[model samples]
Target: MPPTRPSAVPPQGDTGARADAYATAPLLNCLLREVARPVPGAGEPRVYRLPSGERLLRVRGGRRPAAPEVNAGGTWHRVGHAELVKLVAEELQAHTGLSNPELPAEMADSRDAVAALLTARDRTTPPDDPYRRSEQSLLTGHPYHPAPKARGGGPVAAWLPYAPEAYAAFPLVLLGVREDAVAEEGDVSALDAFGTAPPGYQLLPAHPWQLDLVGPSLTDAFADGRLIRLGTTAFDTWPTAAIRTLYAPEHDLFVKFSLDVRITNDVRRLWRHDLLKLRRTNTAVSAAAPSVTPGAWLSDRGYRTADFAFEELAVLVRDGLHTHLAPGTTPLLAAALVESFDDTPLDGLHDPAAWWTAYLRAVVPPTLELFARHGVVIEAHLQNCLIAVDATGTPVQALFRDAEGVKLLPEVSRAAGWERLVYCLVVNHLVEIAEALCERHPDLDPWPAVRTAFERQSLRLDLPEATALLTAPTLPGKTNLLLRWTGADGADARYLPLPNPLRAR
Candidate 1:
């Protein structure tokens, strides 16, 4: 039987409290992981000491920690989102000896964004489709990023309508670029189906929200005959977990646009350098896909944009599920399994161990094999992966997408590539899912199964990294809190050692 649907929406009137709880978890995770030291003890609410300010902090729950309290004169007091932001800012400043005016505001903006999303979700009906629900279910996104949901700190009205968390689906605003001014590579033929351009132009669809942001800069192009506004797409495209990328079910296509907004770490524009390398990176992954069976690579087919507004107006066409997904399966975002939704396959499982085993089987091998054989290190983080399940909710296949995040072996040192893969696959992806599964099934220990998965895959592929992974005492956890505090580039990943769950008995 298919899983029953439960309301994933926040309880009606407690939106503020719910938002605070949802927002606080990730921020706390960042602070705890990057700056604070855990105070060892057996207790209901675990305690931690902020090394910078010598402050005592405690929180209830694991994975998504809540009910945060700070010790003041040997007494505990609750801290709300605002107070928590203040606390984090102070802690980070003292810890790093660097004050960032922007990150703190972003931390607060992220909390406010959650409140706005909750308010929007209350009025909006979630999509009945399980896949759509799973894609939109990331209310507490990037569980370790301080400002995962901050939409460039813009007013809620500007970005909320385009938010995937609110179950938003909107039509793409089509534009016509003068044929002479068009700069494109690979196969972007799917874009032509959206609408027709005049004889001298090519059809280029733009994200409505992006169009609004970049519209002012395109005045000269619009005023001249270089870019003409065509109408909107007849069918609405649903935004995936990656905010700028949208899935068009009707066309069986995924179109990614460049948005000039900071989401999580960086401004999400499709930069010229990345765009220049897209085809090469995508080609390598596509070639490697056949070697890894039961796991598919959703090929980013091509991109289209006006040469005049290359990065700002660029749109990428990606292969859709019709071509890649298995016959009798529905693909759910792997990240969604961590941030659950109504009818999540992980919910009420008869045997969570078996389910988790199958999950590891579907997800791990392809990632490891691709690296060992093809020298392709995909960003196999939860958001970039899709776990397809049968009607019985058994994970049958894994699909991975997003070419922009991929790394080629020789391009980066073998050690660097392997480090990136381990961080993405182990710390970011598997750990989150394992914790979520254990959260649901308290008696189930997920690490042994994880160890077995890696061991089996390592033996099959003769991958030395996988073998070493089984015994590694520490995993490289990305220092997102420190990265932002230091104003490091988003792509410039820095790692701190985290206790390896796989190595634990």
Candidate 2:
């Protein structure tokens, strides 16, 4: 569908009164409805009583509709029919890939309905929507965008060309092919595509199931008693890791290859296994996506052989970078910075939101093209970021790594699993660390500064042209958490300052 102006409430006559009115509105009900909580009928909007005893209006339904439910006041409210239809259609599409039922009777009529909705967008009442942005634009950080075609070339110097000499440092080279290559190979193994190997070349079987989607390739290679493993450690979660490279001089990629997969799948050591596999995937894709650095697998199979253990690989990062900041100074330094300034953590967050900026610069436009105008909630924090600097202690790039650390909007994910994702990505990581910064720098607009930092990261990724996603939700908002946190002095900290206004709504 063509992009409509993002939904927003019109400015009222006075700023303070309007803000106060929104502050007293039934924001929680709005969030619940957005999350697809059932509501009453169409004519009757969901009437919710705010904490301050103010009343607010809520309705659901759009191109996709939410579940219908009865409200506490015994009044009837349903996800507005318009919104309900939209969300339900989206949900249906997610499950069966059919936006509407393939009913013989209404199939033809539904076309008219779709056309009307598309045409009458301006007249439609917008539903409760949260701030969101896309991240596919983030691919530019390290030059992972596919190289432009050579004017006239039989073969050009692409980064990972199929060559034997390039295989010297690492013996076994894992190559993942896009699905088309698999069909080209037919029944033949990935090895057959490149012709017979020179002496010391061995074509290990690519994972059988992956061969159809991601192309097959040589799994391992041995040169002078050294083993190099390649392609990827993960083949299922994503469709990409069809090949991996294991390369190290004088070390067997897997000393006991036969027993390796079995031990790593063991239950108890799962965390270690996840760490190794995640690190390995991060290493390869970082280069593939062209992020912070391109990390490849290396060999270190001797000392540890526990369940979830995978062989090690050397990831190629800039020479002087380390993952963390200077020792001991990290947590305290973060807190001290916030405290010295006398500002709150939220103040340091980005204004137009840095996550959206970098994502637009790095991942979108020419590469992914998934979103037209996106709003990505970056969720950057200590654990999700690497504060890399130069020789003079000047900050360079705030490396945003870890795919699992970011949260996409509910519309993108479809499932309402956002709460957990938000908890882990935003509150758990970025806010937690920013809280320390705020404690030290009380005078700073911590949130906006953080947003500015996100913008800096975006600029590093070459996204200066795109827009950012930093506007807070414009509707009435509130938060009512069920749990509390205890402070260092053992005082109740459960009544935390919640970020989203609609949380209580």
Candidate 3:
């Protein structure tokens, strides 16, 4: 897709008025993916059989499905987010005979959140910096998630100040942890540069919102003089697409903090179990994929936290783009690449096929090779991946991060790991880019090039899943709508079968 105007200035005015359409699309996708059924032999006005006593649901479809209607009495009526939420609640209760008042409220809350973000954006100018703008560009997040924008049903004021989508940036709150209570692992020495801690303590950086979240519980720690405030960083760090992670442009570093809010399916806390396993996962990934020219891994160097408030105040030191990113190349979040931006290098391409070829060449091989050789399963989803483009805006490098999401072999069954790998790489990451390309170049069939990319790599990879991958009719698609509604653990991913594009001729 061509780099369009600022997201706030979409094709339709980005007013509170169009927030319904913007908010409704993702909701509809969630409903369709999780519960809606298609009417057999239905013609023209596309109808999908929805869950509430088998009600007929209709919508205009393309990439952004719109104008949802449900058949009631003799005619069709529009279903806004409120009505949609009610319908979903009713259907869920009827289908499972279990009422979830919370999810319905959350669905409505998500709509309201979108409205607020739109209002905030229209009044505030988006950052001119491409990277910052890209970071803030996710207005309608997770196209298939039910409550993608819901901020734990908390008041907007509680989170709005630090919202990356609102072009917000703030300095991290640094703390001095008592030397006795300081619990750290690996090389977190870079944290020492944020500010000097008193000789009796070590430097610890924390997310301000999280600090505010757990303030009452931490009273004893502060009273005992285990934690001391050391002020903030000189330069403000911009929150990346992952809300917990912040990128400091000056130091060229990323620091991840634990926020207990539930963004999508899971509470965003950096759990102790995951943190305990981080070093081993990170080391495996680094060894699995060495310093390949166009492919790199941004290591999560180490983490620092006080033993007293382990998960709450933890800060992860991540390798910055400076070392991994090719010199003279600008890297943007792959998630933002799919959304509307002021200037996207992908838009500059004269040939979609050639550009697609380069993209596949840069991204596909290393991931396959990693799994085949090292048995490291990378959660290479959009938020965890970045594509760096040369001066021409063509992609030159692929960088991946988030060791917490990576799984090693034998930790999970090989089949289970493969399912995760396919969903993240193919369904979550590649599908979005492919759809954007097809939208811009309607005549171009991007899947054949995708097929070619896999075929070339299959020769190098010894994995048996490769042949089945090219021909499998269905692939695992994470059922976010159901996952959230059922209150499943965020990492406890349950996938539904989706029509596989790779299988399409």
Best by TM-score: 1
Report the Cα RMSD per candidate: 2.2, 22.2, 2.0
lDDT of 1 by residue, 1-505 (tens): 3222212223445888878888888888888888888787737778898966567999876777788899957899999989999999898888878999999999889988999998898898999998988999899899899999999988888998899999999999989999999999999998999988889999999999999999999999999989999899899999999999999999999999999999998999999999899999999999989889879999998888999899999999999997788988999999998875888877879999999999999999999999999999999999999999999999999999999999998999989999999999999999988877777777999989899988988899889888898788999999988898899998999999999988956
Q: Rank the candidates by TM-score, best first.
A: 1, 3, 2
lDDT of each: 0.89, 0.26, 0.82
**Which portions of model 3 miss their true places by more than 4 Å?**
1-14, 41-45, 291-293
lDDT agreement of model 2 with the native? 0.26
User: In model 1, what are the clashing residue pairs, if there are any?
Assistant: none
The RMSD (Cα, Å) of candidate 3 is 2.0
Q: Write down the RMSD of candidate 1 (Cα, Å).
A: 2.2
Please provide, for model 3 over 182-285, each residue's C-alpha lDDT reduced to its tens digit, 9 standing for 90 to 100: 88888999888888899899988888889989889889988889998888878798888788899988888999999988887778888899899999999999
* Segments in model 2 whose C-alpha atoms lie over 4 Å from true places: 1-268, 271-284, 291-381, 400-425, 451-497, 500-505
TM-score of each: 0.97, 0.26, 0.96
Which has the better lDDT: candidate 2, or candidate 3?
A: 3
